[model samples]
Target: MSEMMTRENLTGLYVITDTTRFQRAALVESVSEAIAGGARVVQYRDKSDDVARRREEAAALAELCRRHGRSFIVNDDVALAIEVGADGVHLGRDDAPLTETRARFAAEGLDAIIGVSCYADRLRAERAAAEGADYLAFGAMFPSPTKPHAPGAPAEVLGWARERLGRPVCGIGGITATNVRDLMAHRPDMIAVISEVFAAPDIRAAAEALCHAMAADNTESIQTTEDPETS
Candidate 1:
């Protein structure tokens, strides 16, 4: 694994938001606070069909992430990501094929930080890695009300992916500071959360707390030079 895709560099929390009832300015303010508190990545995942608004929001978040030196990912929308000059794009199982996405990113001269939602099972993750996915996502670990449509992934899947896949692995769905440490035993490359950070009473504090806990528990993977986290 490369340094940019390592777990240590991304040991902190990642926040994803669709539509917050809060005003856009307030949402941006909260996001800024979260970044200051140690959010490594922020993904804008609006499912709305409004192209102009999507482009605008993507641009705004891209600028915010740029200023904070954090990565910005556009979820499930390659065209919008291109329009906003986003740092990366995330794909679901039903989205475009990995080869097509890679080719698109290559054409643009971008690094193509493509993340694949593997849902569950090592087979999917292994396939994604073999196909050149930048990161592999596993879970719905706990019951994720945010994505009830997602299939549940076993806790052991993280360990399997850790041992089997060379690509960075991210555990998502209902991931909180309390349960996140359990995943450390698996040595996944990253953890992705929705309500745990975004829906918290204090987004900034929540993000920082998660980062601190993961940092402490991730000592082994991050400290060992041979571990990909230290790569």
Candidate 2:
């Protein structure tokens, strides 16, 4: 991981969610619970075209993350991220290029943290690193309810990315406590979750359990495995 990402001392849980799924009270409640359960990053991803609402939700999430001493990231909208004074923004491939994104944030004096979604391609991951993205994410590792039709990324790609990108790498999609063990060997800097936390019956416990699994010591076990599918 780059010294920039490592400097934050962030590990384990990162939560991404939409505003409609969580009202004000529920959003605050869930965030409080997740932070208490060890979430170090909270990403607000609202795909709606309603700019006003997106701004509102981003501001709220940024405030919550700030209160908890965690990083707040706005998904897909660099403008909204700046408007809300968020810690950073997460960009998809189709979004603004990292160079432009960084320049925009820097112009605003934000020093924004930028993360790119590289899916499962090593080349794309390498490109993101070269572009100075603070982190790179891959997955839909399992059947994710948020994006069910999204193809899964191989678990071992995490190792390939860790070696090449040298930046914090995140695994997203259908991550959960039960199957997260599959990703342990890759040693990602963190895991980005959606329904696993908000949709859980007990958000706090679910967050805690997932963080524990990610933090478990399984380096030897994963390396010894004979999965030719992995790099």
Candidate 3:
């Protein structure tokens, strides 16, 4: 793990900021609430083409997450991640290659976490791991407001990934307190959320709920594994 994903155990709520819902100023407040509520991971995910605005918002968010001791990531923007001194970058199919990103991080002397979005393709995830990605994210587990047209991934993938990759597997897309159980059944290392955390009326409450769910799920998994009869 390139020091980018500094967490030894990358399990729990991963909050993503939505530009549409949280303005630049409001982004800090909402993200702070998420941090207070126990969100350990945050991603600055803005799809806008406005480089200046993105730089400004991402810088602020990176600083905010740093203050909370959380991993701050830039979505699909290597340049911005480097500029903001982010923990890492999350890349989609359209983004630069994972190998390139890894090499770039090294060249820049930055400890960076390189996360790849596998969507629903297990083969792609396998390839990503082989290529040195720190973590794999798969999602659209349910109907998602963030990516309404995204294809849904089976929860089983999370379990398979955890076993196969031997690294953190993040489940994303429409994950909330209500539907998170399905994903949790697989014991994913993390679950990424956009609107649920940033757009909620009470950001702290929403994040807390998700955090509690993940902790409970992880604890259950540990207990089950350690049980003599189950073993």
Which candidate should be chosen as best, given lDDT against the real structure? 3
Report the candidate with higher lDDT, 1 versus 2. Answer: 2
Error of 1 at 163 (Å): 2.0
Q: Which tens-of-lDDT digit does each residue in 12-122 have in candidate 2?
A: 688987466786667778877888888888888877787776677678778777766788888888888888888788999789889999999888876778888988776
Per-residue lDDT tens digits for candidate 3, residues 154-216, read: 887787778767878999998888778767778888899988888788999989998877777
Give per-model TM-scores. 0.87, 0.89, 0.91
Q: Which parts of model 3 are misplaced by more than 4 Å? A: 1-9, 221-231
Off by over 4 Å in 2: 1-7, 217-231
Q: At residue 133, what lDDT does model 2 achieve? A: 87
lDDT of 3 at 121: 89
Write down the TM-score for model 3. Answer: 0.91
Worst 10 residues of 1 by lDDT: 1-10
lDDT of 2 at 24: 61
